[model samples]
Target: MESTHHQFYELFEQLGLPSSEQEICDFIDRHPLPGDVKITQAPFWTEQQAALLKELLKQDADWAVVVDHLNVALHH
Candidate 1:
């Protein structure tokens, strides 16, 4: 089966966050995650956002790649 690809900004949009490149950069800068913390467990996320992120990762859905990218970005 062919995989569906999604952009990093689209992940933010789906989470009801600012989707602009600058905004995404700002968000990551503001909410840096500790090395041990998972992105979905970040305090900055709402319940729905966390749930969506968990679901995407659990299912390895189309948004999973972007979600992983965001996770790495936050930890840095």
Candidate 2:
């Protein structure tokens, strides 16, 4: 699971944020999913980030595998 978390590196880098695997984890820890909001809908995402997330899930893209890992992390 920790390794799967690193799969977000390319995404965070594309967003021009701290892109290290550890930094991404830290960010997730800092900005948790709101009770009523989906992880992809969390305000921390930019429009592009949101869309990418949706598209990844929609198409069952390779990234979607890691995104699903993240969704699980968000819940617990």
Candidate 3:
């Protein structure tokens, strides 16, 4: 399956993120399916994706963990 950052950028490009951070926030808030969550089947995801998703789901924390992952992916 594709990694979260790849999925994120794909959605970002699709949604035209340049409009505003609000747009990005709304997009993220909408909670697109992770590669693992098949609509008609059981869950499936790699260890890395699951771990990252766990962190991503932890809102109300000080830092933006999902953005951190995206940054790491971008640098690599």
Q: List, residue by residue over 1-76, the lDDT tens digit for candidate 3.
A: 5433334544345323533557655644554555554322213334554454456445523234444454343333
TM-score of each: 0.95, 0.72, 0.26
**Which stretches of candidate 1 lie above 4 Å from their native place?**
none
Model 2 bad stretches (over 4 Å): 1-6
lDDT of 1 by residue, 1-76 (tens): 9988999988999999999999999999999999999888999999999999999999988888899999999999
Question: Candidate 2 residues 15-44, lDDT tens each?
Answer: 567987789788878877756788678787
Q: How well does model 1 score by local distance difference test? A: 0.94
Give the C-alpha miss distance for residue 13 in model 1, angstroms: 0.4
Better of 1 and 2 by lDDT: 1
Among all windows of ten consecutive residues in candidate 1, which has the lowest summed lDDT? 59-68
Angstrom error at residue 41, model 3 = 11
Note the residue pairs that clash in candidate 1. Answer: none
CA lDDT of 43 in candidate 3? Answer: 39
Number of residue pairs clashing in candidate 2, backbone atoms closer than 3 angstroms, sequence gap of 3 or more or interchain: 0
Better of 1 and 3 by TM-score: 1
Models sorted by lDDT, best on top: 1, 2, 3
Which residues of candidate 3, in runs, are more than 4 Å off?
1-7, 10-42, 60-76
